[model samples]
Target chain A: MSSTPTALPDPMTLREVYQQQQPYTRMTPLLVSESLSKLIHGDVLVKAESLQKTGAFKFRGAIYRLLLLTPEQKQQGVTAYSSGNFARGLAAAGKILNVKVTLVMPADAPENKIASAKKLGANVVLCQQMEPSREEAAQKLSEDIANQNGSILLHPFDDPEIIKGQSAVGVELMQQLQQQQINCQSLLCPVGGGSLVAGCSLLFDPFHTSTQVFGVEPEGYAGMNQSLLVNHLSRAPGKNLSHCDALLARSPGKANFEVVRQTSVKGLRVSEHFVVEAVQIAFEELKLVLEPSGAIALGALMQYPAQFRGQTVVAIATGGNVDKALFTELVNK
Target chain B: MSSTPTALPDPMTLREVYQQQQPYTRMTPLLVSESLSKLIHGDVLVKAESLQKTGAFKFRGAIYRLLLLTPEQKQQGVTAYSSGNFARGLAAAGKILNVKVTLVMPADAPENKIASAKKLGANVVLCQQMEPSREEAAQKLSEDIANQNGSILLHPFDDPEIIKGQSAVGVELMQQLQQQQINCQSLLCPVGGGSLVAGCSLLFDPFHTSTQVFGVEPEGYAGMNQSLLVNHLSRAPGKNLSHCDALLARSPGKANFEVVRQTSVKGLRVSEHFVVEAVQIAFEELKLVLEPSGAIALGALMQYPAQFRGQTVVAIATGGNVDKALFTELVNK
Candidate 1:
């Protein structure tokens, strides 16, 4: 893989994108966690993107991606593959923008995710092949559908436009921190294919800011962490099972990895046990319903509290689209 | 009971209280519900107080009540009786203000609520008496304790200052609605002892604004609803079981009822089944964790969609202090 990367979006462009999406996107509350703050002996803030439209930060990217579509592309529509969050976001965005959206999801994806996507007026095709991984199989199916229908193909997280769109989360977080007069020392974001972290990292001036950004991933799917360690793109071994269905991507997207590599983003992996505990903590303490993937950043904090101890920290709770049964089982555990 | 009431606080006073408490309180997000809007053929916005500090709007009133205490009262501390939400809120408020708090709670209150109050540094006493109603029994026990210790007795919902503090919710809602240019026709608040409804009602001018304020209650615990209909205070029959633990108060507090009665606030009630469904809907659609009592207002909208059809509406989701077992049970159902 090439080590060199394309230029990232400047802060001005990021702000412009954010301003354009401001009316459509929700300004999710930046909540201070008393319990976590006490535990870590520092201020712990949660940027609850789980409360965003379509129950995830993906909606920002999805909406922006659709808005940037060429007139012809918008008319023809778009297709994409996602385990859940992005599919729902894109489906809703498509509905809002009057663009046709087709989603290819794994056959075994959470029932609620599939149902929500369909309910949002997406044409959903379930891919049953799990031999080469559900994500890859679904991506292949989506590409085939796009080719057949002459629709533009959308990558759930790897695209530059999508990453630019995801930067709105970072833009909003910076604004909130400024408003609250908070100077956070550390920032944590959950990484699936790394679009959220990649986009967010673009906002902080690594040369001047003391803030250290971390891309947190589940243990089995620590591809981003591995790639960051090796200083090159790498795939996760994918040997272990995890409940974070949304963070099961085997590798970071090329565009996302490129952006992250150009920034000062460190990668951290959290155990499955801690991810479940994070979900429960979010429910009990933060009063937020976070999926395992969304809670992964907080899970990293719990897993490595000493590293962030006595330092103001911000954790992005990226999504809350977990299946009811899984959420119940995890919280109960 | 006498219908004549004490003078209500004006809008300026309400805004003053809100400003004083603004720095301490969370400006919880006002979320638009596409599903609910489609169901009623109107714009439905949810004021998610479930995301408030101590996981309920009770924190607003609790903090304000403690702030208003004299130096002697602060030094001597205070005592109150509540099923759960107010206990947790008061305990948290006391912790923040460095005031000692003692709470008398019904023995059967949810385990999480009791645990949270204790965790917040409150001295908790469980009242086992059920003959005169759990709320009355607890109130008596708290009064006895207050008298013995010379600590001031605080009414959980009946106090005028507390109502003024809770008016912050309405104040914030109006600001958010104004910012969004939304002119909602109806406002619904979950009614327990009715402080929230009364406080919010004071903000909307009955003689000017066309918006109708509603105090929504569980079917069996419709004390506030019944009182509003009869133009005086009344007690609920309290013969049926309900999951709305926070809203089991047999009658409205005198101050709350008086304030509500002076306004044009109507009453609405929803069944146990719909309250459970509202919790599920809040979880699925709004990505919010709402306790049964917190969800009753949304339940009212679900129960009476015809009445709110084609009109913009706002429902205050008051709290998210439910136990894990019950929340799991309700959402799963």
Candidate 2:
């Protein structure tokens, strides 16, 4: 009888990822607070991706993809599609590596992102809304470039290498906890493409503690929950419902979903209204700007206080690259 | 024949002031930058007063006044005037120090500041604005409070101890410069009431090098500049032209003014239009929110970039608590 080989227990070793990716990515601190602890009825720590270079955690995956390139590939450069954080990250990384880049962005991307990418010397391509999705339009552009000039396409997530790279955040989190001598009961992170949570689970698996990890998604974009319940894959990359434009992954990453399925982690969804309230609370109380997607974990904490009470929890404060106009709209309203 | 003792090189050593007053004050960091170096033509560093706890440097002097209170004085609490940073600082410090504070504010004071003061547990006494000088009415309130119950009055500036406490920013700056091993050619700080620039001069004076200190004042509030030409004090505190409301300080501190006069520093005034532009640049380029007063130095940089072309300069980004509504109004326009 023939048996299928067991999948690797670890997606990638923490040490190897650190050595390969540490130079390019930020070691965003796991900031803990006495005040936050008191309010949440437990010790609370925030992995401040808002403070990450380029103002988002997307840099970790983008830079990791850049690192795997051959010198020739580096010279030829790469291309990707994102309307927001990823666009900024790829452009920024391209500027640092002195590599030419082509970006396929939605025509309605934030002006700041467009200007920032242009400032970093990326040849930005505007796509029509006629395409069903920005991701599909971008994939088509990537294929065209691959056929014509053999340029590499850097997928934002769903790529195994990118998933492995995002796992570095977990490694950093564990290292930081050890340094501070603080033991956490659970890890709470926002789910976008599911790669971040998927990669995190692999890192947490070896600890062998009953420390449960939870992934939060905006209520409208919680495709991961439905996928996990029935084990059926969705056709696309984002969920159908989301006021948070960033967290609208229609489907989870296949590899990441596999890892997340095996881990003893629970997933939860938060309402768009709660996310807005969380954003306001962050500004008024913590003096932080948490974009709608970034506030999902905090929104869960506020909406369901009992679920998190008495547990030492770590929440990822994902990013702070808010459009000035959108920020005014939300804050003023 | 007898003569009064000559003033000490640095009168009223503020080391003790800083130590005892620290709890009541927010120790704003003097953040040095590599990015700013590209614009100022030298190694440009920003002392980010914009990041101060109450979002301005005025908190330093307000807290210093509160800290210097005698036991009897502390029991009765404190009172002050103005509808800007000082009001906010007094309220915040008063809450922490367990002192009751009553502020005489103009009816036109930004709703944000008034609300912030109320949130911090200060009693607000709104006054009519028909009077040409609101400072006069504030002084009257301070006197009445002193006469009735011996409540201490905290002046926005023009107090020696306040000047001494404000000097601590200078102290921190010199230490930061030394730690970074950067030999700064000059220090440029906004000249509001002159306390900030004056205090900074004292801090820079002890360096034993020919370091020029410059002050940037809003064009409308050029009281300090006019005063400098005549070698005579001009415009009583809070009685002068007010464009940058936070910098409406008419008179420089006597000791602070003396230091500015004695030092080899220059003063430059930038237009309001340029100030708005600088504030925009701050938001776009530096990813910071700066009030008009806070952006005055950046305004100066835009107006006369050549002046800073070759020298290692430090510009104090002195405040950031602009009314969000006002900021939207100005920037959107």
Give the winner by TM-score: 1
Single-chain TM-score of chain A, each candidate: 0.98, 0.89
Candidate 2 vs. true structure, TM-score: 0.82
How do the predictions measure up, each by TM-score?
0.98, 0.82
lDDT of each: 0.91, 0.70
> A139, model 1: CA deviation in Å?
2.0
**Per-candidate RMSD vs. true structure?**
1.2, 4.9
Model 2 Cα lDDT, one tens digit per residue, A155-178: 777777777777778888888888
* Tens digits of lDDT, candidate 2, B73-167: 88988877865777888888887778888887777766767788888888888877435555556667666766676677776676667777777
Report fnat for all candidates as fractions from 0 to 1: 0.83, 0.05
lDDT of 1 by residue, A101-120 (tens): 99999998888889999998
Look at candidate 2 and give me any clashing residue pairs.
A220-A241, A221-A241, A237-A250, A237-A251, A238-A249, A238-A250, A239-A249, A239-A250
Instruction: Name the lDDT of candidate 1.
Output: 0.91
Off by over 4 Å in 1: none
